[model samples]
Target chain A: MNAEDAGANLAREADESHGRTVAAERRALVQALILVLLTLWTFRDEVTKSVAQASTMTQAAHGLALPALAVMLLYCRRAELSRDLQKGSWWGAVLIILAVLAYAVTTWPFYVSYVRKLQFVTAFAGIALVVGGWRILWRCGPLLVLTGLAMPIGWNTYSTLSIRPETLTMDTALKALNLLPDMVVRLQGTELHYVHAGVQGVVGLGDAHNGLAAPLALASVYVFVTFSRVRPAWQSAILLIVAIPVVALGNLLRVLLHACLTVWSGAMPAEGLPRDVALVLSLVATYLVVAAASIVLDHLFVEEGGDSRVATTIRR
Target chain B: MESKDIVRTGAIRRLCSPIFGTTALILLVAAVALDPAMTALDIHFRKTSILPRVSLSAFDAATLPSFKSAPKESPFLDPHPDDDAGTRDHVLQRLQERDANGTDGQVILFVTYYSDPNDQVPHTPEVCYRQIGGVVRAIGSRTVELGQGDWPKRVEVRTVIVEQELANAAIAYVFCANGRFYTRRNEVRLALGWPGDKRVYFSKIEAVSRFERDEQPDLAMARACKLLSEVLPALLTRHFPRQADLKHRAVGAAR
Candidate 1:
């Protein structure tokens, strides 16, 4: 063949090869979708119970949004997933079997309420491994962790763990509220007594007020860490480490806002639309703070790249 | 066929291979179906092993000699609200007494009976007090001696002092699960959840007394403890399920 003819033939072959890889990736994704659906269907009851708890319990309300956030995180990485898709391994089947058996034991012989909820996450991971292989599982690790965190903290567990944070939140809120001119806020135990403009009211900082902000803040941090492409596990660790005080500050802000509204209105709206709105606003503020910190970190630590000036100078 | 058609057909055939596709579907279906089947099995297990207990409604609070049933209105104390009716039975009472010091001592008695094995550990004074805007200052367990002929000669009860903005409360409570007394919440959970004897039941008897700034918690604690000792024996004998009945049920299920 002439040179022109040979070149055209080679280009045609490359097109065919590219077509085959794309087709294979598409098929694998469809299969993975089917597996995910099956896993979710199987664990529908647990998910429903979790959703109900998240809706009613203030401490777990953030759980209602986590699943959707996880899906969004996965969606953001679609390009990476499509590029790295491959045939799965038999080990995924082993994981699926182990998770199913553990779920059965928890369900029939002994009812471990919390552990049974966790099996939903394990089954999802196993499904991901089965359909998209190890690379996909690695890529989707943060989303999986997010899904696990989405499970509602059981009432017993929340009651046990919330005491210290609750006390700290109350104390910080009291301090902040007192800073307002013409507002004298006093905390006696969990109740906050406020006086402003000759108006007096008492806001009882119950379970509803104390625990929701921290978990909501932590969930928001994970969302940021997942979406912002924060690198080097240590950086993510720092973000997580700073999240505690951020959560405390957010909770203090929520209490101060709620207490102010209660004092001004001459009624204690401890739990209702006003309190919920204040909580959502505080969470929004928390997210903005976290986003600003993440951006600062991004600027402070630059990732070394092949085209970087420093790398180019070293090569020269 | 053209080469392109051949490649497309080959890909479809590989993707839809019957053996591999069928096995994957079967495995997933089995995993999906496992929970409901096992939950059915659990229902069967619960049906056979559940013990019969006298309902809390049958226990008349007025029958006690030293205490009379007063109105259930307390500023600092309220019953822990539970939405799931099927899981537990709750009764709240305000008991009143005129102490020897001429001070009218009032105690709020809250009792709950749980039979559902899936139910979590019952809320304790530590959690309940906090829910009502009270901070728990101190919590510990104390042994209270019951009168003669009581099934348990001595019982350990959790004692907590809670401080609210408007008032302060001294509280004491104990859990009777599987015919034994327990002070801690986890102990009660373990006893009720033990698979050895599946006849699971637990009752929490809690008493709270509100004291002012002038009075110490000792007075409030003494009043609560006094009420607990007077009422605990009656509940064990008259209200709770007997150990003999549980064994009989087990034997019948075994047969």
Candidate 2:
């Protein structure tokens, strides 16, 4: 064969190989599309059913609120591609598959345990998918955590935070109030009475829930308001840290105020400014104060780069 | 295909299935791990005027459903427009109205009529109290006011001399405010001091729970026993009159 002819033949073969590669890629694209569509359609019922079930766990006011926030966040960030988009993990798929097994077990409706198992599996797997597996697809881990809000599953503040030194806080609050000026302050027999007054409240019962949601929420707002103008990351991280206790402290204050009022007034809490009204008023006040405090904090602490800590680190 | 395309191709579909799938699994595991806590609260089957009228419970499922599926407000619970709001500001105001400025030893038995909302039968108790020196305030807890002041308050407790014949049936409920529910620590009287013989079910309260238990065929005891309890009320009342009714005919003879 002539040299020119040989070169022409080689070029043709190269073209053929390139065409084959493109064809193979087209096939892969079609398959992936089909897989995505089918997965959503097939599991659509389960996804919705799971979310619906989760929504029930939240208080009536907040049942749908979390999901709404999730959607709004995505809308706000639509311009940016998420980091953890669609890398399928075996762990994630295993979760839904358990439902299939759970569903089979549930065939015997007479078996109460199996029914409960079905419910539990559905909730647990669905949540893990959203939190952990979804994290595989997203940049924001905090938002992923927020998804748990779909079901406002909460535990008693005491149960969750009991190990965090409630006794010390109670003593501090009482000491600040000048409640124990004379008698030695000691928690006895799991119950403490103001031996002088014979009035008893659990010394270590420093929980955020016992009708102090408003105050706690307010205190949290204070921390955030105190630090708002700080850099987004710093503000978020600091506010996040500050929010829980701000709310807890706010709650403690409300409780202390109520206990004091009850002892002094000799009237029922429901009667004095009324418990319900006090709760509402305190909640509103807390929001206002927290917002004001955050603004003040932002002005006082937020420097050029971020908050004082971030600035100080940069300075070094 | 390029690597980015490869990641994108499988990504979104891979994302949703497992995230939700696993969350559900974990929640299920947690639910399984948690012990079932069934509390008997809510008033439906039997009649008792002592409890507050708010029947639409925020708590769901496990407690028995109000026997009537159709929502009708109880006449008792319906807030009275005619009632003075200023007078109603305090729980004590309501308490005083209930007590009618009384004096001396009297007791009121607040018993649990039905607790399980899933209970098929029509027995719902406002609160459950066993009559052996026992007074149930709501459910899972009860309090007897020994009156304000001093150590080792002398609270009125019912003591039984004989079964079925109530010696201290005449009583009134003590007014308690703002519930404080704590975790059952060693504080829940974890001590197994004695056999539960001193405890006896209140006659009326027992009747309600029995009615509920009987509805479930599996739990139904074919044979039932009469409610046998005794009490020592702080104050005596005319409503649950002492030795007036023939039901207590056994009182003098048994003595």
Candidate 3:
């Protein structure tokens, strides 16, 4: 197979059931989208009334991020989805009618006091559309259903960052600060207020107040980018999990350094010689550092899964 | 995007009907109709956990409190022994009407905003707009500290009731000082100043909630007296010393 064939094969080999499922999803999305519009148009009175009292409504129906991600997942699976689009069941109208009725009933101020679990209706509709679309249409679009899970799916994790790396971040950074000649550092909480008694505070600078979030966020983004390339589902998941701490530690250290610089310079003498400016530039520097680190770590860990379907795909 | 280049598809499409297509289209329409208005609702009550304890638990029918704009100063104080301004006595007299009318509690939280002329070091014409504004917002009142609220002598002791829900609802005080929330009570003093300023230093604690009013009588009284001690100075400072003399003393002492 040529490069194009190989790329298609990788996607084709994802899982037969998943491939067919995504192909059939298009009609459903279009159907659902249309059904929603019709129900809304038919019941314009209810929709209008809710707008008048929108400020005091019960249950938030809008979570843009989750729906947007779901839509994207559907789009990614568009390659295999168009074929199976016809095989899906059609309870779309019934759901549309039910959701509108639920919405209309919930609009009354008294419904807010009722024990109807008021938010349940819209949540059910959103889930139905996403999961149903995913099952009927096998594209990544349905995977966006998982994004909504973010609300209730928090978990305790093991990571160096979670292990209270604030101490380690500060200790390593402060040790580096102490090595400098004639530098007096005073740490108040996370702030390292340094007073310089050397050379009329010669115009100079060092990493005292570098922000910590940038390094951590960059590390996370880097690991994600690496995982998408070599493509091991398990390694990708593990790395994604581990990268949280790596990035978090990087961020804590950055903030520590950011505060340290303030002490180093008695006052914000110059705009460029400030922590705020460092924050802007540190983005690129950190991305480079994090990307390099992940590339190295990813290569070190990537094993030939000869028995695994994922490993065989890469060999081709 | 063609049918012949097919890899795989979901079983629902193969197992389901063209009629479901209509249903899918219908639900899509419903989702569109429902989501727009639903998304528009904005709830700020959720921002503060303490608000529910105070306002939420209050009988829903409880309307806004009856307030007659008492003149800016507390009317309880005996007339200033001797003063050029004459207005200090006038300001103190106003609080008497509310007291005489038998309003069970008179608790006024004010945010005075001005550079203290008497502040040592002259602190560079410092400003506390955010800090003051934050306090004003937090307490759900409005105040402008331009002229006479800092005079300490204006403070007086009032009754205290500790177990009040509204009183305890004063849990988190947020102020943006130097672009940071000065959240703690000790931190509040840096910008709030001591009672010496004409207004209540932190004086006059009334049990705003029924629970606290009934539960901790002594603690409430102590808190009320403590509040009066702190607040009266700040309020009086605003008027007695007046801005001109106060600035001279503060700036001059530094010099």
lDDT digits (tens) for residues B8-74 of candidate 2: 8676454435444454444344334322211111111111112222221221111211111112322
Reference-based lDDT, residue A224, model 2: 29
Better of 2 and 3 by TM-score: 3
Clashing pairs in model 1, backbone N/Cα/C closer than 3 A: none
The regions of model 2 sitting more than 4 angstroms off are A1-91, A95-232, A257-267, A271-273, A281-303, A306-316, B1-255
Off by over 4 Å in 3: A1-179, A187-192, A197-227, A256-311, B1-255
Q: Please give the lDDT score at residue B151 for candidate 2.
A: 18
lDDT of 1 by residue, B67-120 (tens): 776644545544443323334466667777733222357887787887666666
Write model 2 residue lDDT over A72-98, tens digit each, in one string. 554444323232333344554455456
Best by lDDT: 1
**Candidate 1 or 3, higher TM-score?**
1
Candidate 1 chain A lowest-lDDT run of ten: A307-316
How well does candidate 2 reproduce the true complex, by DockQ?
Answer: 0.04
